[model samples]
Structures are given as C-alpha cells and as structure tokens.
Target: MASSLGKLSGRRVCSVALGSGLPRSRTLGPAGGRICLSALGGTGSAQIRGLGSGSGTGGVGAGGGARRAPWLVAGLAAGLAGVAAAAFHHLAPAEMVPRTEVASSVPDKADDLALRCSSFMTQPVTALSELRARPGDMKTQMELLIMETQSQVCQALAQLDRGATFAVDRWERKEGGGGISCVLQDGHIFEKAGVSVSVVHGVLSEEAEKQMRSRGKKFKTKNGQLPFCAMGVSSVIHPKNPHVPTIHFNYRYFEIEEADGTRQWWFGGGCDLTPTYLNKEDAVHFHQTLKDACDQHDPGFYPKFKKWCDDYFFIKHRGERRGIGGIFFDDLDSPSKEDIFRFVQSCARAFIPSYIPLVKKHCNDPFTPQEKHWQQLRRGRYVEFNLLYDRGTKFGLFTPGSRIESILMSMPLTARWEYMHAPSENSREAEILEVLSHPKDWVH
Candidate 1:
C-alpha cells in the first residue's frame, strides 16, 4: 500500500501527452482559401489572402541561402491564421464555423469518443460556451484529468469499505466552468468523506485584480479586466475510528491571462494526516510515503514542502499545528509546466497508498468513550483552523458562485468544544497534544 503509486491500474486510464505533436507542418485554412507551408518552399511565395491581404516569403531564399528559421515561419503562420480567424469573425460572423461543427465531419466513432470524454461540458450553455471559446484549453483539460482521478480514487476507496460509495453531484457555475462533488457520509469505515473537483473561469474585475496584486501576484491587467482559470481536486476524509486518523489532499492549477495575452500559471497542492491518537509507526509510514513521491521529483521537494505544510496548516491563534505535516506547496511555477503537472499527478496517485494501509490496520481498533471525545475535541480545532485561516476556504468563499457544500466539505461530521478540555499529563492523549504543539519530522 505504498502511496507513491506509479500508473493507475485497471481499464480506466487518464494520461496527458504534453508535447506530442510539434515541429509538424499544419495547414491554416479558412472556408475558401488555404495557406499551405509546403507551397512556401525555397524562393517560392504564396498569396496568403483570406480576411486580409498578406505576402510571405519562403523559409529558403535565393542561392538556397537560409531565410527565416523554420520555427519562426511556423510561428508567423500560426499568428497569421489567428489574426485571419479573428478578422473573419468580426467581418462575417455567420460565415465563421464553430470548431465543433467542423469536428462533426469526422467518423462517428471518433466523434462519439470525443464527445463522450467531454460529457462534463454537457448542458448549461453558458458554461459550455466558455469552454468552446478555447479548444484544447490546458486548464479545462487539467480539470477533466483531476476529476477522472477523483472518481478513480473514490472508487478505489469504496472498494475497501463495501458500504461506502460517493454520492456524485455535477454542477455548473453560471459565470464560467463547472464541477463534480462526491460525498460519502456515515460509511462503515469513514464518518464523512468528500472529494470535489472544480474548473472555474471568470473575468477578474479591477478591484479583484488589485487585491491579487496586493497579495504578490506579478501580473498587470488589460482594459481593467483579467481572465482567470482554476482547476483542482480537493478531498477530506473523517474516519469513524479515531485510531484510523483523518486525512486531507488537494491539488490545483491556476492561470491568468495577462494584458499581452500571455498566460501565467502555477500548480499547488499537498496531502496531510491528522491522527486523533498519535501512532508513531503510522505517522512515519505516512510521511515516508509522501517523501518518496517528493524524492522521485526532487530531493529538496520533501523537505521544502514538508516545512511548508507545517507552517501553512499551523493554527496561530491556538498556537498549535493542525496535525502531523505531510507536504504543501504554492505558487510553484518552477521547472516546466509539464514537469509540475507530472509531479502533481504523482502526489494525487500517492494518496491511496499513503493512507489505506493505515486505515486497514486501525479501522476496527477499539476505543474508549473518552478517546472518542478526545477525537471530537481535536475535530473542533480543525473546524477553527479552516474557518479562520485556511487559504482554500477563504478563496472559495470569495469566488463567485462557488458551491457552499463542497467548500465546507472539510468539516467533520461531529466535533465538540469542552469548557476546559485538557488531557491528563503522561497520558496518550496528552502525547498527541504535545506532538501537535511541536511538529515533528516524521520521515527522518
């Protein structure tokens, strides 16, 4: 049950090919005319006329001398095509065909498969229109990928507990994208568990953009508006048995289009464990599983993210750590977007292996009434931290049209706040509090 899983098993597979088709010639044509790169061979010229008049030289010039770089030519061709399309849309809007209609000409099976995979875009024309506006959009694609993973994770978890199955609810945001929320309540192994996937897009107003600038996002707006896309999978599991421990996992991608039409994006997420009763071996195993995933990408990742999680989840008002830290990171635009995405996928896949074995080991362990009460008290702290300090919760609340149910899904099914809740000194409960006060390097 190692959490750092490789490929997902079984028939369901979700894989992304970041840079598969490149350095290939493509015809950028409108309804009547075609601009063929092949026609622009050595010393040759093609009348690239469509929405507007333009003349382009060949990649190779006279005497077979090198003219423009192949990549540059390709880029110019793409730019020309985009400009032409926009001009055509502006001039003769009805003449411009929707890409979906063009795609409909393909074979039935291929078309069917394409539509089936994008079934999430069905209904709510407002949301679908936003998606259609950007074909093969990275944010939308990532949203679908994470939703598929969420389904797979829930399916796998439900298998472990025969009575546990997520109640799926698909929703659309009027402003932009949509999402799926899966919740399992009063299950055999878990008390309350929620797995939510959302892909939301909207125009950030000048005020919102200013707030973001204040928060240190390095981007300027165009025309007092900024387009933003956010996609993520968030989960929280509150187990029935206190010994089994509670867990949380979240992975997300955020992108904003700047004034120059360049996209600024980043990936952020992490997973952590919260055990009401501190079990040394379980804590070690959990951290080691996540550490293995981090190490696979970079030796420095585990330490950095570990410390980040420790700090981020700290309850400043209460002067305590929420739980034993696992890993957390934000604003990670380093390396390459592809590499960062791959790393996030690795962390998502690692969830089951890291927590399942621990659940299986302790799910049925006996607990006293006092211990159960202790668990409830611990849950109260979780509620406090999320309401007052969790960045995710704050953002969700601010986001227009965010589903309240999914936003508050992290709350435990039951929790209590005693007048003076203090465990006896030298007791196991007291030991947990001690560890919470002083976060430990479980892996080391």
Candidate 2:
C-alpha cells in the first residue's frame, strides 16, 4: 500500500533500475537489443479527447536493468561526462518554443499549443543529450530525460558530501516505456535521492478517448494503447542535516482526450521546499522563486495554486502537512490549451534556477550522525504521503498495463521508524518539529 514501494512484489520486474536509458554494457546486454516502445522524439503530449478508467486487458511490458545494474552507474557517469563534453564542445542547447502571444501565430491556436508542449518536453532531452547521458535510439528521448535530470540532481548532492559520498546506481526504464527511475545509497547529502517519470500511450480514437476520460479516469484503448499519454516527473532530495531539511518536487504533462483518440496535451510541474528545520529566509526564497515562475504565466495563478498546494499536500495520517504550503492543483483544464502548456513550461524552466542554488548553498554543510537520523525519520513520513495518498501511484498501478518500476521510484534507499524516539532537547532537529507541527503559508 505504501506508494513508495519495492519492485512490483516478485516475478518479472518492470525495470531493475530507475533513471536514464543508457545502453546496457556488452556483458550486461542480453541475447538481443532491448525491446522498443515508441519512436516519438520526446515525451509526446497526445491530446486526450477523453478521460475514463477502463476494464481493459493488457499488462505492462517488463524490461531491462536490475536495481543493482552496473549500466545505471555507467549511464550516470556517461551522462555527466556527456553533458560536460557537450558543453565543452560549445554545443548549442535545444530551441525553446515561442511564448509571447505577439510572436505566436494566430492562424492555428491548437497547433500552437501542441508545438509549445513539444518544445517543453524536448529541452530536457537536449540537456540529457548534451550530457551524453541518454539511452540511445533503442530508447525514446522521454526515457533519456527521466534519467539525465536524475543524475544532475544526485551529482549535485554528491559534490557536497566530503565524507560518505553516496554511489549512484544505474538508471532504469519501465517496461512498455513509461519513463526512467534512479536512486543513490549511503549518501552524505541528506541520505538518498530517488526520482522517476511516467510516459503512457493509448491509441483509441480521439473522440472515444476524450468521451471516456471526461468520466474522470483513464479509458483503455483497444490493442493495449492508452487513450491518454500522461507523462510525469517527480524527485525527492534529502540533505544530510536536520538543519537543512528534505525537499520534494514533481513536473508533469497530461493530455486531454481527442474525439478520435488524438491527444490534446498540456504541461504541469512545480517545486517546493520542505525543511525538517525551518529557516524562514530559506522558505521565503523558495516560495518567491516559485511565485516568480507562476507570475511569468499569470498573476492570478500563484495565489490560487499556492493555496491549492497547501491544501492538497496535507498528510492526514501524520496530523501535519509535509512542508510549508506551496503550489498544487489537479486536472488543470485551461480555456486555451496553449496557455496551460506555457504555464507548465514555466515550471520546468524554473527548476534549475530555483533548486540548484539551494543545493550549492547546503551541499557542503557539516552535520553529525544524529542529524542524519532525523532526516531519515522525516523520510518515513515522506514515504507515507506517496504510498497512501499519491494519486500518481494509484494511477500507475491501477491503470491497465502500468509500468512497475517508474511508479515506485520515490522510495529512499534506506528508511527508519524509530520506536517513540525523539531528538535531543533544544537541538536543531526539535526546531524542525516545532515548525512541521504547525503549517504556515510561506508565500503570503
């Protein structure tokens, strides 16, 4: 029931590793090349003309990598090396989609929206390609972005761990091509980092998919295709200090069903800061950056969604919310699909600037084993939210033919639920509890 789960129970696993679609080394390679999923260049935002849950017959295709595969290690190194090499060679990054309305063509608003969504998905793949870290032609660009961004985040933390530098395991792709997954162990920057992505496809008629989807859940397409091609990316980064606190963020793209099964797509993603120990300035800075990104799209969005995030993320089991309030909402159907795509794009475009500085600022902080323990305990609550309440996890599992590995990529390498344990009196950790016990609106 824990959404943050282990490899789908037993039997044939979907993916052994989570993150990056790098080719398996010769020794690791199988009798033949890996199975193929789709030729679509990037994460395709197929317009879902409908949304409905169906009782269709089809199972998720299980693919390569063991959670302990050497390829992910190879890919992470290869990805980082590739990014460095690409930048050194002065390679130009991917072209961003035109956002200003004046610049966009009025002749076709629908197509314009599609173009913008595609551009948003393409840039991450470009970044991964520059890192030389993506899985080759055998894998889709969607798989590549999932893994490459993961390595980028993890490597940032590894740099801060002067001692106990965590070893990054191989990145893995889900069966039937949902997305990639990655995790690190014994890390010094907090404890571990886990990330994942989901890319689904259904080939029903645009009208059929839309009609069914309007019912509120996914409707299965005939022949194992999904009516809605939902792509999601989520990550959890835990710093090694009780003083630093942990953070969770997710970026996603959802398609509206087309009448004949063609997808009508829009993008969505946001980052939030969660500290075990509250630093008002750190919280303010985090929220302000998010506010800036939302402001780029609409002045009304930040306030509404910020309140939405706070309400949505509340953890009922814990009697407290995960972190201070941040932006969150679901089924964000905008009047002009193009406008929604731009909003989601803004969130993706905001990640590097918003989070990298925080990681750089705290990666090198000094902390003790006691602080590390507190971080792990907080992760337990993080795990609870994902498993018990995460709609994404339920969708990944309940959806006919959902990928197993990608669904549970948020699980940490190690976690603990201490028996009636408490941190030292008046310690940096207790200060964190005082904050978590009482949630506040950081942005306002």
Give the top-scoring candidate (TM-score): 1
Scored by Cα lDDT, where does model 1 land?
Answer: 0.62
- Tens digits of per-residue lDDT, candidate 1, 338-362, equal 7888788889888989998988887
Determine the backbone clash count of candidate 1: 3
lDDT of the candidates, in the order given: 0.62, 0.48
Total backbone clashes of model 2? Answer: 60
Candidate 2 residue runs with Cα over 4 Å from true position: 1-176, 182-190, 203-226, 256-267, 422-430
For residues 1-444, could you state the per-residue lDDT of candidate 2 as single tens digits?
122112212111112222112223212113433212122222212111000011211111122111111112211222211211112232112212222331121224654332332322122222232224433321233334443444455445434432222222222223322333444433334344555444444443344344446647554344545544455567766554455546667766556454466655544455666776667887877788888988988888888888677666668967767677567756666766556655765665566666667666655455566666666787787788778776556655554454454455556655679888777889877776666667566667
Candidate 2 residue 376 Cα shift, in angstroms, is 1.9
Q: Model 1: residues >4 Å from true position, as ranges?
A: 1-137, 205-211
**Residue 332 CA displacement from its true place in model 2, Å:** 1.4
lDDT leader: 1
